[model samples]
Target: MKSIKFTVILIFMMSLTTFHAQEVVVVDSTGVAQENNEVLTTSIVKDTIKVPFKRFKAEGVTAVVGDYVVLDSDIDKSYLELQQQGIGVEDITRCQLLGKLLEDKLYAHHAKQDSIVVSEAEITSQVDQQIQYMVSELGSEDKVAKYYRKDNIAELKTELYTVNRTLKLASEMQRAVIEKVEVTPEETSQFFYSIPEEDRPVFSAEVEVAQIVIEPEVNEEARQGVIERLNSIREDIVDNGSSFATKAVLYSKDGTAQKGGLIEGIQRNSPLAKEFKDQAFSLLEGEVSEPFETEFGFHILTVDKIRGQEVDVRHIILFPELSQDVIDAARAEIDDLREKIVNGEITFEEAAKKYSDETETKNNGGQLVNPVTGDTRFDLTKMDPTLSAQVYNLENGEVSKVYNDRDYTGKSKFKILTVTNKYDEHKADYAKDYEKIKALALKEKQIREIEIWQDKKIKETYVNVNEDYLDCDFSSNWIKK
Candidate 1:
């Protein structure tokens, strides 16, 4: 996955369109106005302009918008970066890119004018999250530092802080401009009807699935053993001067272990377990805590840094390894429940609500929700790998046998999956695809609002583009020389 900074830049570039055709003008030293066909230099009075003739070699400026300036080399660098990312470098693409950068600068300029302030704590948190993501992708902090030619992850974060802040400010400004945009049902219906029949989209097969999850219960002895192991690791770090990150990578069972157990930008009021949150927030900088237990497992952590109510920390988590007997017990329990469900002794919904260990699904009577759509239905291909494989051959209203699987936290669990509903591949339907069509309409409205905002900002901001780029169509009036 691309880093957050790159993702923001891509969004800006992809959201813009070319402007309509317009006249272009160029002025020369002789005070003669001519059609814009090539680059021209305008002479300035020697006494009025301060030129660093001795200490500087000047390059041409590609664009100037108010106090913001885009050099020729900046545009060249952006084009090269796009090419590296396998994006097209056609003339229209470059024009669109230039327009996006110009608009971004205007958004930042206006944000400053409005006295919009982002806290240092927020920026630091963002930097930490981005660094964690980068470390995860590149396999290690060492690898990430090498990739960026930095001495360490801290250096990389410092380098990216300004870029991230600018992106964040621009994004906030964009949201302020369009946060009130909404599409009503009537608007959605009208937009759907406006699409020609031949141009309507087709959808793939979809399914609605649900499950009852049963996590294996670790015995007291096993739990104590995990705690003891974490205690030993903590001792090693405290007394032996051993690297916390190295120990975490070697011993931690959490998903973040690959990134040296770093959890970035965690707030005091975050959705962590109360026990875990209290323990983390109470630690002094660089102080390691004693082993503590939460729902997931035993953990020993040290606070790397703290900013106000937020913290950056590294931890080693050791989950009790479930014994074979525990696994068999969970499997047997799920199997008995399945039998009861199949024999009509109890409904699956009732079993899920009464016995399933998955809090989110149990409360919903085992109904799986699609996070992206906030619906129970999902494309078969998009379903969980373990659930989809078992449900692929099952018909609607059929239940699968108890199967061992892992949940999002990577804990082993036994589950009985049911396919509640299924739909074959079909073309878009007004009644069936109302949510999808409505989302599209909402996006279209948002784009229109953004375009209007851009046009107003373009006219208000002082902008000037080089004659070479002035000939290209642009979405904004950037040639206000």
Candidate 2:
């Protein structure tokens, strides 16, 4: 999802909106190892490449908040993958990588200059946890160690953590800018009512609830069995030195297995729902992890390099089956929660913990998140038809009769929903718009502050620009004019 941004930019500055949790790899500006002596080619998948370090290029710029912006997310791999996926375009992918890099450098520089610190200790701790998580996802430490070509799985983690932290700090700075904007009652009311009646959002009674969920415990023996199976397969691959992709097609359980288990050109830290993410990135090239475990089950990993802004990896995921007896026990428990809530013995929130399907929702009282937006609020149209139908009919405190729901794998599961809160549609009132108004107002103030600082910095810094780029269109008149 894209966030609102208002910043002045130079000709070289790029802008990108990333998929959440996708890792945004930052390039080394101080000195990227020089590439082959040949001219950089903008076309072809593997252009006889010999490069010391990765670099990005983009074309067709846009202006955002005075910054010459572009999107250069994945010039090479994105294009090849998109073409495979039936998306054809050159400049589009070209800009994607450039935009990501520009934004990364700009905000990262500001964070360091402002002394927004991410401590060395914090980075090290996060790296350690990440290594363990990778081991878990790969089903064992050895599986991870073999894939990365590193002596061990823990090497260079501090380096990765530092880059990750830099990006994190930039995000916080962006949030600070947007969250502080101040908007008044008049502004909110005017912005809201100014829209046509037909366009005004029809708000149904919407309930916002928080929840914590714990999945049912899978039998330990069953989990161990899966890990053992994976270990044997990994042994076969290693012993024979067989092609990993070829083996993945034959044995990998993930959907991408048929394609040799390769997932490429994806941004870093993207919320690809699986504990395998940490494991996938943990290995250095040519290394593998032994069998490890996660919420999804067991897995083994093979990590490629951090090429350009993306990392390539593959995995075999193994999930254990819960017996019919386990399913019945969980369902019966959830049913009992309904009875207690019906009897007024305890609040639905209370029963959620002591009873109910304790996994995936009880922590926040069985509330479903807006999966698409990660929002609690959903217009009926944006909701799942079956769930929305039930929600519309049920009054507050009403527990839905057991209905069908699908887990990530599209497997059918039984679920009960409760309508905990609702807001009816009405014209926007300033009193009710405090958060939004305050946010907008604060943003405007931040831009003013930054603008003042930027104007002063531009005037004071001893900067020089080559003639061709000096006249290039930019967000601010920061270059020598």
Instruction: Residues 1-481, candidate 1: write the lDDT tens digits.
Output: 1112332345445322111001111100111112332222222232122221221213467788766676654444454445544565543245555666777677767777777776555666556666666666779988877765568767677756765555556667877887899999999999888878887878889998889999888789888898889889988999999989999999988777886888777787677888878878999998999999887778999998897777888989887877889988998999899999999899778899999999999988899999878988888777767657888998876779878787656778889988888889988899998988888788778767777787788788778888768765555567753
Question: How well does each candidate superpose onto the true structure, as a TM-score?
Answer: 0.74, 0.51
Please give the clash total of every predicted structure, in order: 3, 62
Cα-based lDDT for every prediction = 0.71, 0.52
Which model scores highest in TM-score? 1
CA lDDT for candidate 2: 0.52
Score residue 170 of candidate 1 by CA lDDT: 69
| lDDT: worst 10-residue window of model 2 | 25-34
Given candidate 2, what's the lDDT at residue 326?
66
